[model samples]
Target: MFSFYNGFKKFAFAMDPETAHHQSINLLKRFPLVLSEVFRNENLGGRYGVQVGNLHWDFPIGLAAGLDKNAEAIDFFTRINFGAVEVGTVTPLAQEGNPRPRLFRYVEEESLRNMMGFNNEGAEAVRTNIIDSNRNGKVLGVNLGKNKLTPQENAKDDYHTLYGTFAPLADYLVINLSSPNTPGLRDLQQKDTLLELLSELDALRLAFPKPLYLKIAPDLSFEDIPDIVDVVKEKKLEGIIATNTTIMPERGAGGISGRLLTEKAALVRNKVLECVRETPEIQVIGVGGVSTFNELWDFWKAGGKAMQLYTSFIYKGPKVLDEIKHGIDSVMAQNDLKSVQEILDNINHISKP
Candidate 1:
């Protein structure tokens, strides 16, 4: 599979990034069941089982948001053996996203930068796709966000509408307040704004039950993390997805991806883990610059309960999943650890600053 992907990349790289993405998605959708069957074996490689809240995933590695924002590829990805797939940054209404050339590749860095402003086929269209496809067995998480044109003060209403519409279909809900592409989106991460946004969402959760995760930025100040922790605890949210795309270094118009942000992500993960470790109730999902097995191990070592990927998948293809899962298992065996959880417990003690 990887050999073919490499050969394909030789041609795909020449095309525009967004064009390549659409082409690949179209291919995946054409033979969804066949693709899923091809990758379904346990030995095909991925962390076999991981638990988050009430949901139990078949693997810890998953395709992140922005890949299938409209839920068009849900059936396709499900067949491919991902433990979970997070779809959307879906808005209250449909959007075309940013203009053309919004997605760019820095081949030298093995990274991608994009300012795709939460474009999607709207919540209602995505809901119809999911319902019609009937791809419900695999764990599915829906990432929700406000429209680009929506006012900051009106953001809560947009989220509330999406939550009500998608919550019944999602195993988990990710509040995407972190993507740098959307204007004023990251500002919602501010202490007071986050508190209010999450407070309203928390009240909504009572009427509709599902795990809620706050997606945060990797570029946050040290002082801001504790405030986020306070809000999570106060609102009784299910978890936090530490370290979204970074806006630092000013990579033109969009946020940069891949290895550049790994250390920063780890720092934030450690901080959040330290703040919440004593409480032990808050779950953490780590993402950012994770392209190697070592980085995945480091994320768990730093106290992430689960981890996700996006850029790495682009660089290494599906083969990276097998490599990381096998590497983690091998390292666990070398240390005489009985399970991934035990390895995580051992490292959590040693990796802390």
Candidate 2:
């Protein structure tokens, strides 16, 4: 089956990156049920499930946002091994998003750079898509972001509206203030602004409580982490997702992801984990440059739980997930572990590759 995707990649890779992305999305849109059969591991999930706040992921690894920005393929993603599927950096209104040639690939680095500014089918349309799609009982999250046109001062309004729209629909909801593509988005990560922005949602959260997370960037200074952590704790949100795509200007504009992001993202994740160490209620979902089981192992070692993947899925296809699952199976077998929670409970006792 990997050989099938390998051959298909040759054709997909020949075209522009964004076009290839659309082509793949369109293909999944057509044959999701069939694709689900080919890719899903029904019982594997029960063996390896991990708790993330109120939600339980079938496995630790999930499909990150941006891959399915519009919820177009929720049926396929949730059907596969992905423990969870997060769609959208959805806005209040439909956006065309920062012109073409915005998505670029670093083939050798197995990385990507995208200046795609929350280009998604507005909340109403996407909500309709989610209402129509089958989540297969797997966790489904919607990553919310302000529309490109929404002013910084009114940023809370966008989030408030998105929260109102998705809370009942999604298993969990993420407040994305991390993507570097959007202008002035990161500014909201500042402690005062973050508090103010999240405070606006307190009323809605009380009315309809949902597990919420603030996704932060890898580019943020280490000193800035505690403040963000404080904001999450103060807001009584579920946890934080660290970190989002990084900006490497030398590589050009937009955020850098995959291999290019590993070291930097890990640093931020560790910092976040360390900050939240005293507060077990807060979980840090490691993202960025998460390729194989090694990264997941490292994250577990640092007291982190589940993480998400984007670029690695592009470079290695579904086989990457299978390999990671195989790795978990082997480690658990060797250590006489029963479940993923058991491994995490005795994480330091387990052997690593």
* Model 1 global lDDT (CA atoms, 0 to 1): 0.80
TM-score of 1: 0.93
RMSD to the hidden true structure, all candidates: 2.6, 1.1
Number of the top candidate by TM-score?
2
Candidate 1 — which residues are off by over 4 angstroms? 37-47, 134-136, 345-353
**Cα error of candidate 2 at position 297, Å:** 0.2
Q: Compared with the true structure, what per-residue lDDT tens digits does model 1 show for residues 1-353? A: 66676876777788889998898788777877765555443463333567777887766677788888888888877766467888998998999998888888888888788888888989899889777765647889899999989899999999999999988988899999999988899999998998888777766799998889999998888899999989888888888988788876567877877877788888888898888987877888888887877777776765666788888877776777777777766876677665565666677443321
Looking at model 2, report the run of 10 residues with the lowest lDDT sum. 36-45
